[model samples]
Target: LNGFRRTPRPLIRAEYQHWAVYVGEGHVIHLAPPCDLMVALSFYFFLYNVRATVKKGKLYVVVGNNDYRINNILDEKYEPRPIQEIVQDAHGLLGKELPYSVLTRHCEHFVTELRYGKPQSCQVQLR
Candidate 1:
């Protein structure tokens, strides 16, 4: 992470637009559903997961939206939380379960909450 900028960058694969927070050493923390699909309702709740650390190399194949325009715009509006606090909070949330809502608390929401102390998803906004 150059500039220690732990921003929430998108991971696009075909039609999927997933989001993750880069926290240096080529690792990212993200909230994801149990499967490849973005939303899954299992009886009662769609499971929103926190992947403790994922390598950037594994993401190279599906990387898209290189400009990270959403993040840039959001960064401009909200004063981001300090890198250390953001990272620490992310680590602390690993293995925890967050309520999953496609139009609300998804991956983008998760990382933004970690980075900016506010939960906002451009995906949700676009919807």
Candidate 2:
């Protein structure tokens, strides 16, 4: 399990607002407009700012909880192709060939290292 910190404040602010700071004149530094003291009192994690550099000509496909075909499964019409087939189709559409072994390795790392377990209060429901 990843050892992360949890602060007294919730993860998200009461309301979302972009913020900026400036320094000039005799004043030390200050923010302008849209600044509510109540909203700014909350704490958030810095790790949420992680960034990734994806190479051009490469594409990423994501399947979230919303993508699950549970109704199709119940109706007996559910048929899902293997991830390899999906990736191959994308490569064909792009008129290029990509490395399968490398992609599989990355997928494994994403599942095991990055998202090994669900977070608290996050659950998927199927009916």
Candidate 3:
């Protein structure tokens, strides 16, 4: 991840307009945007940092203003958490180069608070 430069340069903000969180059993989610989406792309930039690497299917996330949500399009009920919390959580989880134990402990504490309960089961395998 690159930080701001001393000299001024162009910045590219993601163009995706909406975000939603769905809790389910799938390892991947299909994103689709809404019809009358009229929000700033900045509002949903956190999706860029997630860095989901898919193997078999099309595995790239980009900024598009089409009707897309990252999880699933058919499922109806979904709620999105604040982007700030997601960013901070991802920073700690994704930045550290540590053993699984260390990461899982951090995830247990952090995820519990983030979800307001203990996770049924936790797994921390680096990809």
**Which residue pairs of candidate 3 clash?**
31-69, 32-67, 32-68, 32-69, 33-67, 33-68, 34-67
Q: Could you estimate the TM-score for every candidate?
A: 0.66, 0.17, 0.22
Q: Each model's C-alpha lDDT?
A: 0.57, 0.20, 0.26
lDDT of 2 by residue, 1-127 (tens): 1111111212144322121111112111111112233223322321222222212120111111222111112113323344344333323323222221111211122212212221111111210
Worst 10 residues of 2 by lDDT: 20-29
Residue pairs with clashing backbones, model 2: none
The top-ranked prediction according to lDDT is 1
**Model 1: per-residue lDDT, tens digit, 79-118?**
8888888878777877776676665666677777877888
Give the range of the ten consecutive residues with the poorest summed lDDT in model 1: 50-59
What order do candidates take by lDDT, descending? 1, 3, 2
Clash statistics: count for each candidate: 0, 0, 7
Per-residue lDDT for 1-127 in model 3, tens only?
1110011112234321222222222211212222122112222342222221111112123223234334222123323345455434434443333221222222222333333323211223321
Best by TM-score: 1
